[model samples]
Target: MGDQSDKGQHPANSPTPYAPYAPYRRPGRRPYSVRMTTGGSGIAHGFPHLDTVRAALAALFRRLSHDTVSTFPTSVLPVDVAFDDTEDVHLGAQRIARAVVHQLHLPDARIVITFREMEHAATVELTAGPEYFVELNDRFRRHRKDIGAALAHEVTHVWLHRLDLSFPGTRDNEILTDTAAAYLGAGWLLLDAYREHGPFSQKLGYLTPEEFGYVLAKRADFFDEDPAPWFTSPQAYDAYTAGRARARQDARRPPLAGAGWAARLRYAKDRRAAQDPRRTAGPVAGPGDGYAFEPAAGTGAPLRVSFPCPTCWQRIRVPVRGHLQARCGLCKTLLDCDT
Candidate 1:
């Protein structure tokens, strides 16, 4: 086949041009299908077993961002590529979905993109079969800036469905999914889609643009990547800056590295209590089970704080400034210390 310049104008029923780019697949494997429903609170109420989820996502994104570096597009997509026809929208969505799935190493799975004139922005049909179907609200055809983020969010549903992961209930699964999309890399596109000017604005995704920015900023911080230049929307850039500030504020809390399971349980409780309104007293600074604060010397020295590692119960101390690296002397466990 010859190289086609306008890939989007290809025949409607033909296979996506991206099919040849699939990088991962096992021979003689039959595709399995799983059905999942779409309807729940988009608000983030946190998720159960969050620590484990975060740990898994951290490892997955570390590999995906490094190995599948080209999964994301190289150039910034125009935020105003409007479409008047649903077929054109579907074609564009297909191209974006192909790029995302190929990057995630899912060479065998095929996703069918369709559209419906609906109130909700978009949804993915999680069926108990191999074929994946994503339906976008036809309204989005006019709001082209959201195409990438919406497709990324739905495509993430397919990936998570294939992994057979689910939260305890429906109330927070959407938030978890949103977090996965952002933390896993697609969330950057969502943040970049955020647009607001006076009365006209468009924000698309399971989570609010601010929440998306928060997760993206957190991931960028983890990967040591600068996300400022990637942002096209001024509103998104502002949200990202604010989210980074929040992450830094939360970083002031003590390290939960060396505590035992029981102690870690108590630490979670204490951490929540510290945020309770009735608890007006600040975090007690002492050399006890909880975090301890060390007074600075003279006038210019920075105050240092210490916390027990969740792994080996060793107290690690560092200046109360920005995030720093720490190594437990007893267990020799390396840690990323923010407190």
Candidate 2:
């Protein structure tokens, strides 16, 4: 997120969350800086809500120091914090970078934060900056809760980068990082906001409210806690309802058949499908191919057997003799081979 204006800024103090630290400074590296703006008005129009969010986050952080000792395992160190009244993207980027370097003790990693002037029509956007760095926009900084959340979110990314832990080729990696932050307790404040306001409702281009809630739920499950109280969004409520139903269904189902079943079925189906030229051309292959053979020809080549989705009752096809890990395209229900 990028800053909205360039006035009424304040200098950071020692105890301030934005204070820079000695460990964060690097020789020949540009320092990170922050700028705050003023002269905006209206409760729904500008920075007031953002300020409220920021104060809440600060209070939440202070409370966490006392209430969540077990949740956050990192050593709390002094950090140098500051804000600016300029839109110089380079300076804003440096400010975030300095904060991370000073706060965390990761020596081998190089961190950079960047801001860009995006079209006003766009919401807040974040991306991996140059050379193993993370970037946030000024509009993001304008919203205090979003700033805290974005910082925590990006910091988690840096932590994961340093640890060489990442999911392969999916946005799910970012979601995992968000979950990591909530699990670690730094970003649960953001999660709380998300639960309240719903994600992206503030025009921040991050996770949707349901997506945030889903990850929060996953984090709670990982830590064995009840997530209901922390949630605040109507979107979160709906997701929780759906998630609870799925959990109940999972509880009633038998254990998955295992890798042996997957391997056996995959090999069997592939082998049969490869050998039968007719199988390539139409729906039914043959009676002995382990598929429920139907002579109907217009339903397209039956690569799998059709079953009702447990959640929605939509007709879904599962490979008759292949790995049975398919999920419903409609209701997202995962299926086992036994129908």
* Model 2 misplaced stretches (Cα beyond 4 Å): 1-116, 119-135, 170-172, 186-208, 237-241, 244-248, 256-339
Q: What is candidate 2's lDDT per residue for 40-142, written digit by digit as tens?
A: 2211221112222222223323333324424444422213222343543334544544554434433433344444443321111223332334434435445
In order of appearance, the predictions have TM-scores of 0.58, 0.39
Error of 1 at 75 (Å): 11
Among these predicted structures, which one has the highest lDDT? 1
lDDT of 1 by residue, 86-160 (tens): 445556677677765654445545667655555656666666546556666655556665677676667776777
- After superposition on all CA atoms, what RMSD does each candidate show versus the true structure? 11.4, 14.4
Candidate 2 TM-score, C-alpha based: 0.39
Best prediction by TM-score: 1
What is the lDDT of every predicted structure here? 0.55, 0.40
